[model samples]
Target: MKDKTVAIVGGSSGIGLGVAKQVVAAGGRVFIGGRDAQRLERALAQLGPAADGHSVDSADDASVAAFFAAAPAIDHLFTPGASYALGRFMELDEATARSPMDHKFWGQYRVVRHALPKLDAQGSVVLMAGALGARVGLTGAAYAACNCAIEGLGRALARELAPRRFNTVSPGTIDSELWRERPAALREAAFESFAQGAPLGRVGTVEEVVDAVLFLMGNRFMTGSTLYVDGGYVT
Candidate 1:
């Protein structure tokens, strides 16, 4: 990974931030983008000189365009940033039901579209998916569809883009900052439920998922594949 510059959207925190840290540790440079300016500042401080960042909202076309415009040529791109509401289809209003497709699915779509021109010819793109994409559950209909769309987009792009590889990483329940806002009791209960469902018998860690992302980024022969880092949960 030495000297490679990776551009990560939604990298201010959670899995995105974890990937940034690892990229820097491996002697690569990172250009991270996120909506939260303060959090982006903090992340850049933590990552030191090897990392830089821009304020970007993946949901906005102009913001995403400018974010990439300011960045130098990149060897790889990782988009782990997306925001959406999840609920049963009938319970959601039209806009609500479509939020995941708008934000999570189309958001990454915008990012990748803007990135291709600047991406290295041999560069790789890794999109984020989740266990829900493969294993459906109640109240996650829109979310699951969004993930499936992303995986399909990745595969299609792999074929269309040729040498510029594309892949998706679908992770199961991970004990990451995404859950930090939840009440302790609620968080623990959800974790317990997820643990019982997965063969690993516990939630995953950010490092574990990040490892898979790094592998996908480094493996030139891997493209059009959806790698599950879900601890057998998808099986």
Candidate 2:
């Protein structure tokens, strides 16, 4: 992976940052894109010299196109940004539910559409999904639909890309700020619920998800695969 260029959309935080760190550690150059300029700058600073930051709203086609245009031939592309809207199905508003799909679902699609020509033949694309794609329940209509769509997209891309490798990483409930934002009791209860359901008896870490992404990116032989890093949540 030495000197390889990696572009991560929605990489300013969470799983994306974890992957960026791994890429840099593996001697790869990483460009991270996010909507938050300050956060992107901060992440780039934290990632040190091997990382570059770009401000991009993945939901916007123009922004995504410009971002890919500025990025050099990339050896890997990952988008870990599909998170939005969590409520009971009955309570979900149209805007809340559809926003994630518009931003993350189509956002990832746009990235692939624009970046495919810029990828090396051996390059890989890792799309982020979650156990929700397969497990069902808990997450409301929005997340369920979005994750399932992501998995479907991964399958299609893998088939179309053929030797180029396209795969999906489905992580379980990970310990990230996204969860921490919830009320303390809710967060604790959620974690406990996940711990009980998973055969591994615990939630996942950012690093664990990152490891899966790295494996997918490096394993030239793997494609059209949906890897569950969910500790048996879907099982």
Q: Quick one: best TM-score, which candidate?
A: 1
TM-score between candidate 1 and the true structure: 0.97
**Candidate 2 per-residue C-alpha lDDT over 66-174 given as tens digits, one digit per residue, 9 for 90 to 100:** 8888887898999876557677777888888787688778888988998888898888899988787788666566887888899999999888877788999988899
Residue-level lDDT of model 1, residues 1-235, one tens digit each, is 8999999998889999999999999999999999999999999999999998899999999999999999989999999998888788789898988998999889999999999898999999999988888977677888998899999999999999989999999998898988877789978987887788788889899999999999999998999999888878742
Model 1 clash count equals 0
Show where candidate 2 strays beyond 4 Å: none
Q: Would you estimate the TM-scores of all the predictions?
A: 0.97, 0.94
> What local lDDT score does residue 61 receive in model 1, on the 0 to 100 scale?
99
Q: Considering summed lDDT, which 10 consecutive residues are worst modelled in model 2? A: 81-90
TM-score, cand. 2: 0.94
The residue pairs in collision within model 2 are: none
Candidate 2 C-alpha error for residue 14, in Å: 1.2
In order, candidate lDDTs are 0.92, 0.86
